[model samples]
Target: MAHLQPKTIVIVGGSLGGLFLGVALKQLRKNLNIRVLERNPTCLLHDQGAGIVAGQDVQEFFQRHDRTHTPLAVTSHQRLYLDRKGNVIDSEDKQQHMTSWDLLYHVLRANFDGVDSEYAKAPEPQDNEGTAVYGYGHQVGDVEIDGAKPLVIHTTTADGNTATFEADLLVGADGPSSTIRKLIDPSVQRTYAGYVAWRGTVPETAVSPAARDVFVEKFPFFHSNGVQILAYTIPGPHGAVAPGTRLLNWVWYVNYAEDSREHVDLMTDKEGTRHHVTLPPGGIQDAVWTHQKEAAQASLPPQFAELVAMTTVPFVQAVTDVISPAAVLGRDARVLLLGDALAGFRPHTAASTNQAALDAMALAEAVGRIVEGEDAAEVLGEWEARVLEYAREGQRRGVEMGQRSQFGVHPLRG
Candidate 1:
């Protein structure tokens, strides 16, 4: 890698996936020019990724690279399953740590920029400063190779002007609606998994005492014939973990046949805007939220229902699955797709972020030889195989887990 190092690298999307790859590459090569482009006007974008289950890959990445690795999660040691009457039907002790999406994003953005400030609330960069730069309010407009010498990344600036950058390498971490993946193979698309998640978070201080008693310090799960719900605790804004300041995060997965009337209705918000990917918070119509709350009362245990009732703004994430035909694109292997851009999984596994971390590490190892013009085809072929296999297994596992929780679940299995 050191021998075949490129002069410049450009990464699209400033979320965890892109930032992690940028950080990983910087760690791998010193004085390597890197730049990250994000569509948000600022690195500060509000989120719906309420909580992340800490995985070893993300944990290790921070340990090895981050200058001031602050503890970033809240831990729970048990899982509780309850009945309609609020009695615990089953419980298991499996210690786990959870973090908020915003906190993780903030830390990574700061680390990528090598900035020491409250902007991302991460430590100052120990060495990197001018080596990498982050551009906000920039949307990637087009990416095409300039005759195979350097890949061109065309972006639309904040004021609607075009800007282009030429890089020896381009990483597409642009998330579920990845422009890079689609550009490489227009036929690839996400397949809806016949369900959607209603996710929300309420502050610990807002939780009723009875609800708090059941949900606090534990991950609670409740299921009826057609629904499954789980709730856990995560730190509040900016990693606030103190008592009464933490958030009680919940995700409720409900099934709806694709192309059914029910599916279309849920996909449309109050303003009649239909979302292709997700219905962001504050977009769910009041009537729809009311109906969901009523459903919660009928399907969930008393404590879980109470938690739902306390939510002021709930959001919906359509569960979907997708895998790219190729991770390395073009004749030269200069274009690459990582994270959600490469493979998107149903959230049932809670491992998408973990997958992103693993993808970054694996791609960093392959890039050196791919760009060196020696073993380009062989190295990229091996890299794509490893990433695709890993993604396929995770996607299938998520679908299996979801099926096991749905209304048609086989009685013999349980």
Candidate 2:
């Protein structure tokens, strides 16, 4: 009997979601060829300096996949709510783990492509694992899928050179603006949540002793009409988690009416580019930042206000929600969407990264079953049902949380 050919799996978008799925699948099967295409030309992605709440799934992902013993997060020992007057109004002992986006990305990249960085050093590849490739500067332009046939992908390089490749399975882990998602189902669209998060980070060393005393070791929050702010410590530059080395990350969600002048002006960068989703650090215009700082000072607790004032470069991300009609696509179910490509939850629930981790692990298990002589279509169908439910529930909860926090509207009583 002749041995079957190894399957080719292609993943678009090399961010957390794609890397998570790529690493998980690579670890499980040796008779596979995996390629992760990243649009960014540089090997290293810019540090967003944003904090991620390390939910249970995120921790479990690291526990199972991370080979590096390096520390990854800072611990918040309690939930602290501050009144507008800067006095503690409510406090509860609740521990939560926080990590930086840079830290997580570097760690996952190292594990997936055996790349060494300041945050994580890659280990030797296991002999049982398949070939894994990370291609940067490859922008996917088009895709073609046919019934029970290998999928075709066309990509264009930075220099405009085009290339085509074939894959037995295509995974769309690309984020909210995923080209794959558009190709799969254009009807589904992301709906803006009528607000934006003003985000910034201050190094622990830069924060005043008084502010540190109030925020350190605590997950702090402040809520008022039409706005909500939260802060926590996360690993600093290059994954530093030591007491004095970590960074204080804060996010203030403020309402902005769609197409309003304030919204339009805030989303416009210094370079005159209009950003739909995010205005990156240093890209925010001076006037916008100044006005936002004024708003922060007037509305926020003193400590929170001080943190915003101390920030050198602030960023903004428009909150949005999206849930795809289906997770598994294509006539053969060989095409799939994962992570933000499948569902983008509002940030209020802090479930975005957790959802990605969960999706990756669940798909890995399903793939494992398929590798063990199980039917691929049947296994993937079951996986799709499970993940869709998870994503929908997360999306619903995030929207509810956003509603309650931003508008003070509780869920309707039956």
Candidate 3:
């Protein structure tokens, strides 16, 4: 009898990239063992991320894979630009689609976990000892590369205890404040874009009929004095798609000097905790929300102000950017960074989720070559050359778009 060691992959971060990588890899290579580690205590997270455009990259993947309880997105057939009073300044009949963050996350997670979900397709069986494992309470603490092939990953689990495992490949998909990226190269710090994104969602049944008629099944944009606001409808919690159950999602971006008192004030939560990243929903202080409301009434159109009024808990995400010079880590390239950990683009491009989908899809293809006996180093070279180009260009575009929205030139002005 002969014994064999199955190829193993450990993915850090169980959000979009990590789960997508696990599922894509499993779909591509059946005999491989995959593990995804998420620092979050549980899988049922809310307001961490919100609405996302249903891009071609993600839609392409989902077409071949249906793990969601239902279709992942809602379609909009027009683009409407509104003025301060809610007047339709410009309108176009263009088709688009969008989804809520929770919907995508739940679908990907169910596919990775092979679990029975409310609207999830039952995942394919592992059949053998091979598995697509998810570690919710486990957070990656460190990774050590041995020689060239396998990486030793140390993790701190829920109770402050530690554990270690060996993996043939280590992928860091941990997101914007990526621990893996920092550990790999300290120079790639996030650059705050002198602004923050205020986001919120309103249920279809909660708003007035007139507002619902305008916002439902449409993408709307508004501009005022260097501020940009956009809104679209998406599925409500748990992928609810009935007309009255959908959600109206909106994001408004406003500029502020980085680390200045103004910026600090906005990033501070109700309890005065200065959050390093975003002020999640319900964390806003009364004074801050009041200030924002006053500003909206002064600058935004009446309709937008009304939208803000209907919002129960608007959140804030500091606009920031990070692009790593290298994707493959370690002297021998045993580790790789993907998605936001590699480069976080501004929301302007509406490509963040697609970028992650691209990363997972590309990584899966690279693994296919390795399965055909390609050299690991050679595979890394090919993968990096292709993906970094897309990531860098996408990040550049996002920054450019964000700048235009805030300061470059106002679309409404033109």
Off by over 4 Å in 3: 1-6, 47-49, 124-129
Rate residue 184 of model 1 by lDDT.
Answer: 73
Residue pairs of candidate 1 with colliding backbone atoms: none
Best by lDDT: 2
Residue-level lDDT tens digits of model 1 in 280-368: 98998787889889988877788888889989988999888788877888656778888888888778788889888888887766765
Q: Candidate 2: which stretches are off by over 4 Å? A: 1-6, 409-414
In candidate 1, stretches whose alpha carbon ends up further than 4 angstroms from where it belongs are 1-4, 115-122, 128-130, 367-382, 410-414
| TM-scores for candidates 1 onward, in order | 0.91, 0.96, 0.94
Model 2, 312-337: lDDT tens per residue?
98899999988898998866567799
Query: lDDT by residue for model 3 over 266-344, one digit each (tens)?
Result: 8898888998678888899888899998888888867677788878889999899999998888766777899998899
Extract clashing residue pairs from model 2. none
RMSD of each: 2.8, 2.9, 2.8
Q: What CA RMSD would candidate 3 show?
A: 2.8
Each model's backbone clash number:
0, 0, 3
